[model samples]
Each structure stands twice: as structure tokens, then as C-alpha cells.
Target: MAKTILVVDDSASLRQVVGIALRGAGYDVIEACDGQDALNKLTGQKVHLMISDVNMPNMDGISFVKAVKQRPAYRFTPIVMLTTESQESKKAEGQAAGAKAWVVKPFRPEQMLGVVQKLVLP
Candidate 1:
């Protein structure tokens, strides 16, 4: 079966782009408008990986990652922060929150796919 990836971002266009890329790479994609929406989508489902944006309206990526880590069912799920923020402090914060990788925006589809393949649960 294909790995399922949950993508959380406030931008519809960004989600669409990521969805297309993942689909093309033979992975299934679930999209959420923000952190809260992503959490709601995770109910009793198996998500192989997650890609989230750092800044959002309802909840930020770091907080979202922290929330996921607190959940026993999802604590081991790999999360990647896809955002514009490149600051060391922000990256450290994401790491502290349990994100496995960081991908800056304007990313190449190939690069994102590479990371996903490496991190997605088998």
C-alpha cells in the first residue's frame, strides 16, 4: 500500500502543489488548512508522515508537532516542517517539538520526495 501523508498549510495552492507531487511519487495525500484541521484528520487513522507549515492561523507547526508527540498513537509518526522560516531558533523549536525534518518553501519536488521517502513509515 502507498504511504499516506498529511499536509497542513494555510495556503490552498501550496497544499495542491504538494499533493500533486506526492501523488506523482506514488504516495497518498491528505490535506488540512491548518494545524487544528490536521489534528482533526488524524482520528484513528494511519498516517505515514506529515508535512506542516510553521505559521498558521489556528495553531503553529511547532505546537502541532508537540500535540502529535503527546498522542501515543502518533508519537512515532515522522513530521516535516515545510515553511519559509530558516532561522536556527525556529528550527530548534521545531526539533524540540518532535519534527523529524525541515524543508524550506520554494522547495523542489524531487527534494521533498527524497525526504518523504526517507522518513515515511514503512
Candidate 2:
């Protein structure tokens, strides 16, 4: 079966663009507008990987990652943060929250796909 990926972002355009890229790379993509929405979706679906944007309305990605990690079922799920912020502090926070990788905004499809392939199921 194809790997399932949950993509959380506030920008509709970014969600569309990334969703297309992930689908092109053979992943089944699920989208959420923000952290709370992502949590709701998580309960309803089976996801293999997560790609999230840090600064979002209503609960933000950092808090979302922490919440996901708290859940035993999602503790080890591979997560990557996609955002414009390149601050080491933000990266450190994400790492501390259990993100497996980080991708800056304006991500290339090939680069994003590479990480997805490495982290998600083959």
C-alpha cells in the first residue's frame, strides 16, 4: 500500500502545492488547516508521516508535535516541519518535540520527496 502522509498548514496554496507534490511522489496525502484540525484528522485516519508548518493559527505546529508525541500510537511517527523559519531555536524546539527532520519553506518537490522516501514506507 502507498504510504499515507498528513500535511498541516494554514496556507491553502501551500497545502495544495505540497499535496500535489506528495501525490505525484506516490503518497496518499491528508490535509489539515492547523494544529487542532490536525489532531481531529489524526483520530480519523492512519498516517505514516507528517509534514507541518510551524506558525499556524490555533495551536501551532510545535504544540501539535508535542501532543502527537504524547500519544503512544503516534510517538514514533516520522514528522518533518516545513516552514519559513530557519532559526536554530525553532529547529531545536522541533527536534525536542520529536521531529525527525525539518524543511524550510519554498521546498523543492524533489527534495521533499527525497525526505519522504527516506522516512516513509517504500
Candidate 3:
């Protein structure tokens, strides 16, 4: 079965772009507008991986990562922070919160796919 991925970002266009790439690569996608929405989606099913943006309304990606780690069901689900922020401080903060990989914004589709492949085990 195709692995499912939860994509959390406030930009609808960005979600659609990433969703298209993921779907083309044979992964199922669940999209959420922000950290809160992503947390809400987590309860439904097994998400093999997560791609999130750092700056979002209600809750940001770092906080989201912390929250996800606290949940027993989704504790080990690998997360990739796909955001515009490239500061070491922000990356360290995300790393501390339990994110596995970090991908900066304006990324190529194949680059994103490669990161997904490495993290999402079949």
C-alpha cells in the first residue's frame, strides 16, 4: 500500500504543489492549514511522514513537532520542515522538537521527492 503523508502549511497553493508531487510519486496525502489542523488530522490514520512549514497561524511547525512527539500514536513519524526559514537557530529549534529533516522553501519537486523517499520507508 502507498504510504500516507500529512502536509501542514498555511499556503493553499504550496500545499497543492507539494500534494501534486507526492501524489505523482504514489503517496497518499492529507493536508492541513496549520499545526492545529495537522494535529487534528493525526488521529485518523497512520501517516508515514509529515512535511510542514514553520510559520503558520494558530501553531507553528516547531510547536507542531513537539506536540506530535508527545502523542504515542504518531511519536516516531518522521517530519520534514519545508519552510523559507534557513537560520541555524530555527533549524536547531525544529531539530530539538523532533523533526528528522529540513528542506528549505523554493525547492525542486525531485529534491522534495528525494527527501520523502529517504524518510518514508516502504
Candidate 4:
């Protein structure tokens, strides 16, 4: 079975782009507009990975990562922050929140897929 990825971002276009790329790469995708929606979509499902944006209307990526860690079922699930913020401080914050990797926005599909491949377990 293909791995399932949850992508959280406020931009619909961004989500679409990432979804297409993930699906094309033979992964299943679940999209959410922000952290709250992403949490709702969790539903104790088997999400192999997560890609989230930093700045959003409801809960942000860092906070979302923290919340995800609190859940026993998803505590070890890998997360990658995909955002426009490239600051070292912000990256540190995401790392502290348990994100395993970071990918900046306007990313090439192949680049994102490479990281996903590294993080997603077989």
C-alpha cells in the first residue's frame, strides 16, 4: 500500500500542487487548510508523513507539530515544514517542535519528493 501524507497549508493552490506531486509519486495525500483542520483529519489514521506551512490563520506549523507530538499514536510520525520562512531561528523552532525536515516554498516537486522519500518509512 502507498504511504499517506497529510499536507497542511493555507493556500489552496499550494496544497493542490503538493498533492499532485505526492500522488504522482505513488503516495496518498490528505490536505488541510491549517493546523486545526489538519488535527481534525488525523482521526487516528496512519499518516506516514506530514508537510506543513509555518504561517497560517488558525494554528501554525510549529504549534501543530507540538500538538501532533502529544498524540501517542502520531508521536513518532515524521514531519516536514514547507514554508516561505528560511530564517535559522524559525527553522530551529520547527526542529524544536519535532519537525524532522524543512523545505522552503516555491520548491521543485522532485526536491520535495526526495525529502519525503527519506522521511517516509517502508
Candidate 5:
């Protein structure tokens, strides 16, 4: 079965690009516009991974990651922060919030896919 990945980003173009890459790699992709929207989509489904943007309306990626970790069902799901922020502090914050990896914006699809492949739950 194909692994499912939830992608949360406020930018429509980013979501589309990530979705295309994941779909091309034979993984199922679910998109959300923001942290709140992503939470709404969780629905107890089995998701192997999540990719999220840090800056957004409603809730930010860090808060979302913390929230996801609090949920028993998704606590073990690997989360990757895909964002423009490159500062070590931001990356540390994301890690503290339970994100397993960080991928900076303007990323090559192949590069992000490689990280996804490595951290995705089996």
C-alpha cells in the first residue's frame, strides 16, 4: 500500500508542488492550507508522514507539531518542516516541537523526497 503524507502550507503553489512530487513518487498526498486545516484533516487516518510550513495563518507549524505529538494516534508519525526559515534557532524549535527533519524552501523535489523517504514511518 502506498504511504500517505499530509502536507500543510499556506501557499497554494507550494502545496501543489509538494503534492506533485509525492504523487510522482507513488505516495498519497493530502493537502491543507494551514495548521488548523491540517488538524481537521487528520481524522484518525493512518499517515506515514507530514510536511509543514512554519509561518502561516491560524496556527504555525511549531504549534501544529506540538499538537500532533499530543495526539496519541499521530504521536509516532514523522513530521518534516518544509519552510523558508533556515536559522538554527528555528530548526531547533521545530525539533523541540517534534518535527523529525527540516527542509528549507526553494528545495529540489528530489532532495525533499529523499528526506521523506528516510523519515517516513514504515
Candidate 6:
């Protein structure tokens, strides 16, 4: 089966960009505007991986990661946080919240695909 990825971001442009890249790499993509919506989507959908932004309206990436890890179904799901800068404190918080890795924006499709490939296939 094609791997499913849930992408959560407040920016429509960023979401579209990431969605297109994941789709081009042969993965199923699901979009959510914020962490709250992402959690709602997870109720009925199965996802192999998740890509989320650090800053959002409803809930931020760190909080989202914490929520995701709380669910047994999502405990092992790979998540990567997309951010504009590499903040050490934020990265640590994300890691503690159960994110497998972090990707600083502006995201490169090829580079992100490579990270996704390794995480999903490894």
C-alpha cells in the first residue's frame, strides 16, 4: 500500500508545496490547517507519517506531537517538524514530544523526500 502522510500547516502555499512533493514521491497526502484539525483527521484515517509546522493557530507542532504520542495508534508514526529556523530549544521539545526529526524551511522537495524515504523505509 502507498504510505499515507498527514500534513499540517497554517499556510496554504506551504501546505500545497509539501503536499505536491509527497504526492510526486508516490505517497498519499492528507492536509490539515492546524494541529486540532490534524487530530480530528486522525480519528478516521490511517497515516504512516506526518509533516507539521512549528507555528500554527489552533495548536503548535510541539503540542500536536504530544497529542499524537498519547494515542497508541500514533505512537510509532514518524513525524517531522518544518520550521523557518533551527531553534535548539524547539528541536529538543519536538524530540521529547516524539518527533523523529526536524526540517528547517524553506523546504526542498528532494531533501524532504530523502528524509521521508529514510524514516518510512528504514
TM-score of 4: 0.98
- Candidate 3 or 6, higher TM-score? 3
Which candidate leads in lDDT?
A: 5
lDDT of 2 by residue, 1-122 (tens): 88899999999999999999999888899999999999988884568999999999998999999999998878888999999999999999999998989999888988998998889833
State each model's CA lDDT, in order. Answer: 0.95, 0.91, 0.95, 0.96, 0.97, 0.90
Clashing pairs in 5: none
TM-score of 2: 0.95
TM-scores for every predicted model: 0.98, 0.95, 0.98, 0.98, 0.99, 0.95
Per-residue lDDT value at 119 in model 3: 97
Q: Write the per-residue lDDT of candidate 3 for residues 26-97, one digit (tens) a residue.
A: 999999999999998887588899999999999999999999999998898999999999999999999999
Error of 1 at 99 (Å): 0.6
Model 1 clash number: 0
Q: Per-residue lDDT of 30-84 in model 1, one digit per residue for the tens?
A: 9999999999999978999999999999988999999999999999999999999
Model 3 whole-model lDDT (C-alpha atoms): 0.95
- Per-residue accuracy of model 6 over 24-45 as CA lDDT, tens digit each: 8899999999999999999846
Candidate 3: which stretches are off by over 4 Å?
Answer: none
lDDT of 1: 0.95
Where model 5 places Cα greater than 4 Å from the true spot, the runs are none
- Residue pairs whose backbone atoms clash in candidate 3: none
Candidate 3 weakest ten by summed lDDT: 38-47
Clashing pairs in 1: none
Worst 10 residues of 5 by lDDT: 96-105
Looking at candidate 4, the ten consecutive residues that score lowest on lDDT are 113-122
Assess the local accuracy of residue 74 in candidate 6 as a C-alpha lDDT between 0 and 100: 84
